[model samples]
Target: MEEHGTTQPGDGTTLVPGPGSAFRRTLLRRMLPAVAAAGLGITGIAGVAHGAAGGPQRTAAADFPTWGTRWVVHADADTRSPAVGMVNASAPGKDRITADYQVDTGRRVCEGSSCSSYMAHLTGPVSGFLTVVAVAIPQDRLPGIPVQGAPPPQPGVSRQEMLARAATWLTADNGAQVSYSQAKVWKDGYRQDCSGYVSMALRLPTPGTNTVGLATDRGLTRPVPLGELKGGDLLIDATGDNNRHVVIFEKWNDAAHSSYTAFEQRGGHGTDHRSLTYGLPGGDAEFTPYRPVAFSD
Candidate 1:
């Protein structure tokens, strides 16, 4: 992973505090309403509005492609004053910004299979929202690169077969490991911990692009929601009270599906997937979406 330029405090940049900070808490309070309005159900807000100016809007079916190749989110490239700043005061002048992202698919061994890994980047400043007002784009709009190198596979490999292969690679006892205690360590070793694992799983590259984690590392700020989850998405236990961990949403089983699931890694211990369920006991899991760098039609 290559290092990107850092945003200065005076440059309208604010550092994304670790989970449990007053900053994250305040941001989440403002975002809950917007998320509810999007129809994911927050609390006091209504469901997503179904119409536009002229006629009824087309809605994607529940089984529609919840996953996308690439994803893009654009902001008021003309907005003056940062809605959420690093320090006390607001940001200055019109400083429009745009971000592009490549989602990480983790290891290919778990393709189409029921497996687990963590996704990060998506929960950062560029993608995560501080105020419900920031503009965002979904994966349906931005497509990702087609799968390359290997020729197309034979007739039919069930989701089970593909997942088995992907899992082999992911759980292999290789020495690669990540830790959250030190950001500089990850920057230096290019390895990932739970959060980095999820970020890498989505194929999110090092900074220099509109990638989520990179943007977060770059000082883009926001709070994330859990109900809006999709594959290649990030789950964060931001409160830092519960075991601080980051994981990916590989599957969403409606049958007997509790609020969360369990995640198992090669060296890491097993983690409950439902830990991300919104309005949980300890604290809610924050979520953000990312685009797949190698996703295809």
Candidate 2:
């Protein structure tokens, strides 16, 4: 097994101390699925797996090869982060993140089902150790590439006419860092892409979500009507195979559903407001929006 460093989770128990501890080895044995699969997210703290009252917790097996999963692990990880190259979950919620599994991995492919392998990265922290946040997303839909073309409805600072809290991803780094330790990715004012915008706006555990994960993640969300969309809603463009995109719903620009202003991470630009029409108006780029009850604004 590859060893680098160790981490002491909230439970005071050492995972990979000095060399390789029994717990670390055992933990690796359990996290095999994560290593074997190329696109599976952290496999921890992301799935609402078979839970018991303080019982064991588990992550779902890698299934969507064409698609993938996304998640984060909020531990003090540094350059020498020793992941046991296996699949295992020790603590009950060891692998669970607040965003469930809807995240992005910043893989830039040609869209649809490509043959490139997608792996999550651990970005350096501005202050502390690298506690990473990652996800699985399509390559073509990474960031920078607008929904259809350039200027993907990138809007400016929100007016905040009526919102519980202002949308904070308006000035992210335009998905520069594919994935990072993502400490304080939300209101901390980090540069972000479209998925990164969603990650922070929704306060997810990680900053990675592509058009694919946005449309099919089955964590704690249910589909809602576009007309019924309120704050904190998501509108994903699941049109073509590789040209999918997503946006955070602010409010309808008009009552006729003609246009609406929302927040997203654009490619040419960083985070900004986007005035959308193609997906909403319906035609080739018909979009489907979903509302997260737990994360409703």
Candidate 3:
């Protein structure tokens, strides 16, 4: 499958909208019904993570509000393309429902940026309840593609050269490129938008890790307290909304009582660390925390 941006009309990329925007009200109404159907029961109540042998055991949802630690409203054109999994409304061989809109169950796996399509597809219009299962792909299984041949080295390369070289080696030269119709060769490609970037940067499995599945599959299924965040850990926005984003924690700022220096790829940049303040956008940023498998070492 090829990755491209969303093409839905009138979906401008903005972090937040003016009060009383139709989009804002529509989003709220859609989200509430889905949240309610997920058995959230009441707003502001914590959610329970299911245990290995048993069903759900009650647990509190983190107090963090909104989607993503930081996000920009991407023009529909820049948004990742849609893919229908077994759960999506457009899932092959499935009947479409007119009134039922899909809601994200927050069960997600990282398959590069393809995860975005999965999330979006499942959350699109639907009337009945839909359950989503998170699944992660191991790195060794990533598909290979052609990449650009080496370009001549420049004289007196700087830090930028070093970082770019790293990206090239991990993505283009190392069998990491994904197929793109527009170019002879494309690196930093995957079914999802950011997955390929993150996977190559961290040397994690392609198609990336599923935040929910990674937690359960690796035996770190317990809900971590916000205070326990450590450098190198992953902070994931698993709301399944467009506001989803992820970051790698670099350190904690005791003076500010908030973590500092985390890495993320936003607005067409490679992964790099910035202050947590910069990480959090003014609007449309939802986030959840995860520990990257690479960092566990």
Candidate 4:
């Protein structure tokens, strides 16, 4: 998806831990059980989207209640609206985007609500921030809240749509913002790790399901065979406790079908398109490929 310059903690030189690192080796050593427990792993494998709520109609600039105002915050702009379905709320884009101005901002003088408390109610990382004054208030009077744009989040997103979003973000603004654990997006924004990237691409609502949770997620089935792999499948490794990675399978390119292409978010970079070739640097025996339960061959 992208190739930028940024590294995670401890390891500064390389984007990811080399094959010899304890993180990698320990995971590989225990890979046998995880793989066997998964019931699918001989040599190679691979594999690889949410909804919002419904409130009231847009109050229109004239009718917004004087006591409180409305707000919307999302990583994307295209799906935002005054009411749940009032503005750009439409089809094709499906990433949950809803906000309450009175809550996030200290506006409307809400009784008890802090930024941290409001953040818990949010869908994904804080991507967009918007505030609207109930009365005809001047823009300058209020803080300069920019109107960022992103495609609307659909109830369900297709594999093609998912890949398309990944491709755009890889090189665009939100791409590569969050690669490290302690770091935020770029510097201050919503940052997506490997699983976060997939969650965003798939328009998933939950954000905590990492590599391991994703592999065994109820929404998805066990790993599929290499021959039946599809464009939207996933290649993941969940052996280590905090060591895991997930790549969105793009396609394969080899005479024996041993190597393939994928999209992922690495520690050094944000989002990237990669070729998982066997016997090479990224190639390893600990990986597993899986697919969505609804995915049909």
User: Highest TM-score, which number?
Assistant: 4
User: What are the root-mean-square deviations of the candidates from the true structure over C-alphas?
Assistant: 19.6, 15.3, 18.9, 19.1
Q: Residue-wise lDDT of candidate 1 within 88-189, one digit each (tens)?
A: 112321222222221222321111211111111122324421211121111111111111121322311232332232243243334332223212113211
Give the distance in Å from residue 57's predicted Cα in candidate 3 to where it truly belongs. 39
Q: Which regions of candidate 3 fall more than 4 Å away from where they truly are?
A: 1-192, 207-223, 268-270, 277-285, 293-297
**Across residues 103-201, which tens digit of lDDT does each residue of candidate 4 receive?**
232222111120111211222223343222211121111111111121224312467876785676566654333344312222111235677677556
TM-score, one value per model: 0.29, 0.41, 0.33, 0.47
Q: Which of candidates 2 and 3 is the stronger one according to lDDT?
A: 2
**Local distance difference test values of all predictions, in order:** 0.28, 0.38, 0.32, 0.41
Better of 1 and 2 by TM-score: 2
C-alpha lDDT of candidate 4 relative to the true structure: 0.41
Better of 2 and 3 by TM-score: 2
Return the TM-score for candidate 4, rounded to 2 decimals.
0.47
Please provide, for model 3 over 1-297, each residue's C-alpha lDDT reduced to its tens digit, 9 standing for 90 to 100. Answer: 222122323443111111233344344433432232232222222112222222222233211112211121121212232323222223321332121111222233221232221111122232222221111111111122111121211221232332342345324434543322111112222223333344334533222333344344454223345556665455666564664455555567665544466555543444344667423435234555555443333
| Tens digits of lDDT, candidate 2, 59-117 | 33222211112122222332233442321123222232112111122322111222121
Rate residue 207 of model 4 by lDDT.
28
Give per-residue lDDT, candidate 2, residue 189: 24
